[model samples]
Target: METSQITDLKRILANSLEGIEDPIERSRSDFCFYLENVVHDEGPHALTDYIQLADFHREIADTLMDDKTSFLLVEAFRGSGKSSLASVAWPAYLASLNPSLRFALISKTDDQAITQLTGIEAILRSAEHQRIFGDLVPHRQYYNFRAPWSEQEKVIVRPKFSRFPTFLAAGVESSLVVGKRFDCLVADDVIDLTSSFSPTTRNRIKHWFYQVLLPTRDQRWSKVVVIGTPWVADDLYDSIAKEMAGKSFFKHIRIPAIQTEQTDHGPIYKSAWPEVFPLTNLNRIKSEGHFAFQNQYMLERYDVTQSILKKEWLKLIQQDYIPKELTILQGIDPNAGRVTGKTGDMLALATVGIDADRQAYLLDLVYIKGDIQEQLLHITDHITRWNPKDIASEIEATQAHFKNYLEAKLKETLGLDITIRGITSKNVPKPIRLRAMFDAFIAGKVLVAAHVNWETGDLEPLPSLLPFVEEWISYSANAPHDDALDAVDIALSSVLEYGGRLAALTIPSEAIIIKDRENLEKEEEMSEEDLELADLLEKYEKNMTGTSVLANPSRFFQRRINFRGLNL
Candidate 1:
């Protein structure tokens, strides 16, 4: 406030640095420079804001500084400055309180740690902050900071400290075995949720944290901070939730991207909830735009159903279709009248088509309420007008009834060319097919018709399709049944496989060589007198075959590229 108080405060900061050991003297000096000058609106360098660091961020830093908690978890959305808050703000704050304090900045991988280290360097290097504390440069060899010191004052002779602080980079898994213990361990992005979604990756990270990170404390006062974005239903978030179920050692603070249904509609607290962080006025726009409220704020799972896939690709499929020339395909999921009540699943029959370019388009859905004959007759009549190329039916169950009808009655009665084939739910996993379909849409191979019906059951199932695939892949062995996904499974596989959509487009290297060899052999077998004429004929044949193969490499890859302007 006053000139006298400012001078006294400066005197106390200098004295505090001198009192610390020579090994920690620089840390205390830089810490004092940051707090006295940088934190306050003093000197050329000062942090203009602390609230941007998030509410729990400063609270966790304070706890670590006060030695109230040895473990802290602050999870936030991406681009939320979790790195700066932990690696820069907390470390600097702790260093000011206890010069002997040492911290190791850790991440899921070395690259991530180095990226965080770069941010730590940049925040300190800014002209405003650098003027007060001088440059704090990091040594690549040791991954430590060469301390900042003032040479102007004689008594201000800050003792020569370890030119570097104990700041090092190590991956979550490998860093577990390093012998050097730290006063504070910052496990930023420790549980990479995307990786944790895989059981193998989750186990590796879990083992690394439990075996390597947990043992890094040489003193009881050491602290460990786990921070990252919540990407899935499990992993670090579950671990923390389980451990801190009714305890206090593990504190979970979530800084959501936007206002959730809970916050918008649920009761409000007079004081902010320690566990729940509402976005400040400044971050409202960015938070709302970057992440979905249900996912970011409520921490609830976001469902990307099959309906989304059907809706998005419907246009593509529809546009590729020649309405007049379109040939229909009927796919069946027989219910068999097994259920005694209304709760049982209904039998579903889906008819699809492929236009000239080989895009599989869902044409119609036939939902029945009666026996096999009635349902069959209904589907036949519906597809009768278009004269479908083939009726792709699943013949695993109730094959006899379908065979009797096709062989004895339905084939002749409806003049239908029925081809019932069995499809295996093996080999390529459900997710793989869904991923392939996603790749197709992303690459523009798969699209639905414009005038196509969306109000039917075919389009209604799109929203849940991918989510079903995700679950089908995730819990295939344990889940009840994949009937809904099987419908999609059959549709996609039949389109890609039977339609020869992917196969036709991808040119085989073997075909080119075989055609060339055949032409050469024919040339050799010619008589000497006719050899000249034969040679000319052989050249013409080779050129024609080669040109044909080159002209149309693979119908699948080419049509997709033509439609989307991108190759898959």
Candidate 2:
């Protein structure tokens, strides 16, 4: 339909097709050869530098040239040459190689398929391509480019090769289930956060691939190549994991932003991929290696033995003595009132404190039941007894009645000012701070109190707590409700925001040391030293200094204390 297509046809009419029966076949084959060898040849780039991943393009060209392998599974980032090499140029060149190569270029949808074909079709129709390629192939259904390559000058250009090298954008489906037939099946950008997480949508894509795509691939050289940035584990990642189990027809190649190398120095040495990634100033691959390592380079699917959070890190935090000070922060599940009665999750109130050296000490937990008012009263009583500096409460979607009642009661009964800050979140639907906390835990940077129960005692509630955290770590951008894990959510959020300081229920007696045992025994005796210290405390409190600077000894001055004490 465009001028480029017309020019391509005219140029082919002028060029001489080296003896072939089908005009289409001769036309396609020559055009393919020209584009690969001359037009878009990525030559002279060093192989070691990832910049020359044009090797991947050349590899695809060779695979398309052969009749043996039809399926391909490619994993690369956005600029890793997926569209230019795989979708547009590759498929178009394949069709040009043999006009009769009845190939289907599929996409996430029909629209995407058409969209992919547009650029390639334009190139073919362009005057430069026509003059250089020497022939114009008719565009078929906005997908196929038909030409007569094997005949004389006057004959109608017809395809000589069989229908093949089809491009299909498949979601998540395995051929074992669906029965489709094709020479080649290429799936690009299959699953995203918006599509794969939905039960209905995911199932529908599964059916489409199994029932429609696989059954279509019934050829001697049948093959499937999947390519895309992995958004989650459910779609293609799950399939790849399953296929890895026994014998697999699929050959996998994972190319993260950073090329991997091994060295005795640090465990993972940097590889040569940086050469290619570094050339682009907008997003240097080397600079973003850490992000790529977490999001793409390492597969987070089945690395079970390496729990992100090491258990040993939690073991060092054992508090043998009664917590001298404690602060309880309660996170009520946003949906506490919408209970179905079958299974009701409660508001988890976990009390944490700072020891003499600013190390976080977990004291206890109160799992409460009942309506908002009842929970509010319990929280109030707990706070009064502890006299914490402040209760870090999550205000997002909290029950209005409970919040209002608590605030009013605090002002009226205790005359205490309660600060409740809502955790900010966007509509994009992902847990942010919770994931960061998990990362800290996994990296062995966080210490949990050793006194905390892990089995059935105080730690009993935590087994239930861990799965949700794991789910948060393993989740995609737009996931379902995390309302049930409100306690951990609030705690992690507050710690991240407020720099790990929590208000205690009572002035922790342990932080204050009496001058001596005799001073403790003396009744109503106010020494000058005590009065001076008391005056200093009054002045500090009046200045609104919320921090306990001298309150912490040892490693407290630093952002975090090295509580492990070199025991590791």
Best by TM-score: 2
Residue lDDT tens for model 2, 83-126: 66666666555544443333345556545655656646655564
Off by over 4 Å in 1: 1-64, 92-100, 138-165, 232-234, 245-249, 260-293, 301-477, 483-568
What is each predicted model's overall lDDT from 0 to 1?
A: 0.49, 0.46
- What are the per-residue Cα lDDT tens digits for candidate 1 across 41-93? 21243356423333544565555454456677777655555566666656645
TM-score per model over all chains: 0.47, 0.51
**Residue 482 error, candidate 2, Å:** 7.4
lDDT (Cα) of model 2: 0.46
Clashes within 3 Å, all models in order: 29, 76
